[model samples]
Target: MKKYFLLVLLLAGSHVMVAQTKKNGVYTPDNGNGTFTNPLMWGDWPDPDIIRVDDYFYFVSTSMHYVPGSPVARSKDLVNWEMLSYAVPRYDEDPRYDMKGGNAYLKGSWANTIRYNNGTFYVGFCTPNTSRTEPGHFSICTAKDPKGPWKRTIFKEYMYDPGLFFDDDGKVYVAHGQERLFITELNADALSVKTPQKEVYNNPAFPYLEGSHMYKVNGKYYMMGSTGGTTGRQICLRSDNIYGPYEAKEVINDDHTYPGNGLHQGGMVQLKNGSWWFIIMQDRGPIGRVPNLEPVTWVDGWPMLGDKGKGVETFKKPDVGKTHPNVVPATSDEFNTAKLGLQWQWNHNPDDQKWSLTERKGYMRLKAGKAAKLSEARNTLTQRVQGPFSAGTVEIDVTGLKDGNVAGFGVFQFPYAFVAVQQKSGQKSIIMVNADSTVTTIPFKGNKLWIKASVTHIGYTASFDYSTDGKNFQKIGNMLNMALGLDWTANRFALFNYSTTADGVSGYADFNWFKLKDSL
Candidate 1:
């Protein structure tokens, strides 16, 4: 009987493994065959900067407008990654962070440069303005642990893509700019830069050269930046001195690839075994900028990405001493922890009193304040909508909800779609809303609701589905053609609760879990 029970457990685990591998389920890059595929991460991990600290690899990426911005992820092997921490926990400096009268939108934190010097980890990023009068703000975060209680230093002047480098001689320098690259020497604390910023490199071949990350590799100062555009090619400027007459070369391009996509805007890291790898991103339409791990071959001090200077769909895994289980960025929160999952980000700076995980013990309670429209909704917890194909399903209990409260799942953006349950007086109805404010209402009598938003790569459409029993699901609303063009970076699956009535009135929705699946 014990043997039979063990066999049954194994079968159940096998079933779960099969289910997770379903199309648009949890996407893992590791192929389990000593090799891995492109997209080291599945979601919109744009402007990736990777650094090796001891045996672990740390990665940081841009999170425009998403509070708890510039997420730091860790990995044993480059293929598998998990969220370690966020460098900028909150945008406390500006009122717009909380979406005051204005929204940050596409103008929060931009590309981050993460580095580990001695014992502390440093992350530098620039926050651009959403409105005039405010040009931008440059900031740096330092932490003993990458998973941090980070100390931040905000600079009044704007520096685009501020790359921080700690020189071997103990001096710190920053390389930043758009049209022309400037190298400024930082003080001993690395909190501020000295005047008379030296112009190091400028665009001669690739126009609009920016996203500079400075490094001193093998006794040579190498300034790496992307050019042409955001979706351009990777270029490297090398010089023997810190500031110099730098020679440039286009190291990586999309000349040979399945998608023929421009691979750019990422950093390089050499593994313990001395083998180098370049982690870069390519814009994949509505899916946003997804990362591709390309093997780097340094030929005569020049690093070439992928095979003979091009992106490849599959490549040999980084030789990081040991193998790790196939893992993607965190998603599918069960809402059982004291804090929300690291995968979840608020659309903007969230109201602290508005959301909690302890309110319902095993659920996330999103309390709604007054909001006239979905665009005005605050405290909307969101996760990046994965691509190729993916489905995000949530089990929300509407029992605690009051009248004038609308709570459920959303494909959140300017041109977005949402399938939510609305409460009025005593009646509870499920409604699907399109970007143009078109609504499809369904009378839902039950307090327990299971809603799902499924997106397919075929038509690049997202469809809504609702289930009462968590088994049989009925399709509702028109299929939403996912917008590739939005002011924001990418569309996200958001679980929101907001009141449509007076500001004082409050109602809440308890989300039990969010399950996401991604397919090829």
Candidate 2:
């Protein structure tokens, strides 16, 4: 009996590794080989505000209406990180469903998250609706916690993208606006302004739109923000005054070479070796926004990018002094533990009343919610596409996956193509893959099941199995060629779930794990 039990355990593990199939899921960062080009961070990680605190570097980015918003990512070596938590105040939480990029009613905050003057951390962001009613702009939020019940502060009418700075002299100032860049002084607390705001600088020399982060180096102050449209246009600026004669300089140009430089609010941090590095953002079209770390040096007393400079057309990792061997984490999951990891995301707007994890069923429970006719990848409830050229498997034990609606394991190319293993109440489990809405479905009616799906550069395949001894398996074949009819629409890798049934509804499912495999 002991031998039989051991065999059963081995088979359960083998279910994910029966064949050494080369699949696509583990994405390797560009080692600057020129064959591939990729930003250091993948998917909607715009307006990065990073700080080096001790050996641990902390970064917080824009929420833009995605729920459990204001995701804070932590890193030790600067190259890799893990999602920490949303820094927004949870009172009106669940994520904004306002007229945002994803449909959240309240677009939480925009840019510039900073930690300064001892342990006080500051995040600068815009909540659109507040200032819109007053004039031409939105209200900005200032918070002490990267994850916060923040204090929303609106300074002026018709202004957006507010940034705060604490000069070495202990003076605090606030800067923001559109068409023309603006700046004003905030009292000591760095919360409210003591003076009327004024124009700092404006140049048709740039689009002069959202995403502005300012800092002082030597004796000059530099202002960096996004220009042109918020999607792919970006650059940087500098001045000697808190309010300028702000000199607009081209850091990353809007061109084919490094095309995706989208949201451009960022600055430099000093490492233990005293070398400097900066974090910038660029949106990878359909894959959404992501951050990129660039190595920088003081040239001619001004700043210049190092080996991999400015707008990068080719993919490569920044020469951030030295590479810390271990940084990035495993993208897969096994539900053996009770807590859901921080890497998951919910659809456009989340109604969490329908989901739970009580340890009773040993899996995630997703009760049905009023399903909107939502297709935008942002609205489907997704997470960052883990890596570019990698493979992984999503395992779901559907023996008890049931609800008035459907639940499944799916690989998503957001706002569009997705393939899922869905189960409906009193019905056989089904496999779904689609490009637009034209879906192909397969059925499986079984209990005590182990389902695994593998991915590769060529595409992906889903398999189902039942084992009496947990080994020497009987196979269930209904494979999917993700490459065929696969939506090549630019997408970040992600895992997703949702409800199409109704509002005030309910559902549940048990996902075994999601395992990521590396080719190299």
Report the lDDT tens digits of candidate 1 across residue range 34-139: 7776666657888889899988999999998898899999999988888999998888887777878766677667989998888989999998875588778898
- In angstroms, the error of model 2 at 264 is 4.8
- lDDT (C-alpha, whole model) for all candidates: 0.80, 0.51
| Candidate 2 TM-score to native | 0.72
TM-score on alpha carbons, each prediction: 0.92, 0.72
Candidate 1 deviant stretches above 4 angstroms: 1-24, 255-260
Candidate 2, 1-520: lDDT as tens digits: 0110010111212331111112123333333222223345544576777777777788877655455556677776666566665665332532335323334433455664565565666665665554444442333455555445555554454347767678888778766777687887767777666677888877776765556767777788887676766444545677777877776665654322233334355656777777777777654443345566666667665566434344443334434455544334335665455555665555445454545555445555554444432343232344544322233445444454444334444444433344444545566545444434525555666543343333332233332333323345343344433431212122333344444544224444455556655422
Model 1: residue 149 alpha-carbon error in angstroms: 0.9
Best by lDDT: 1
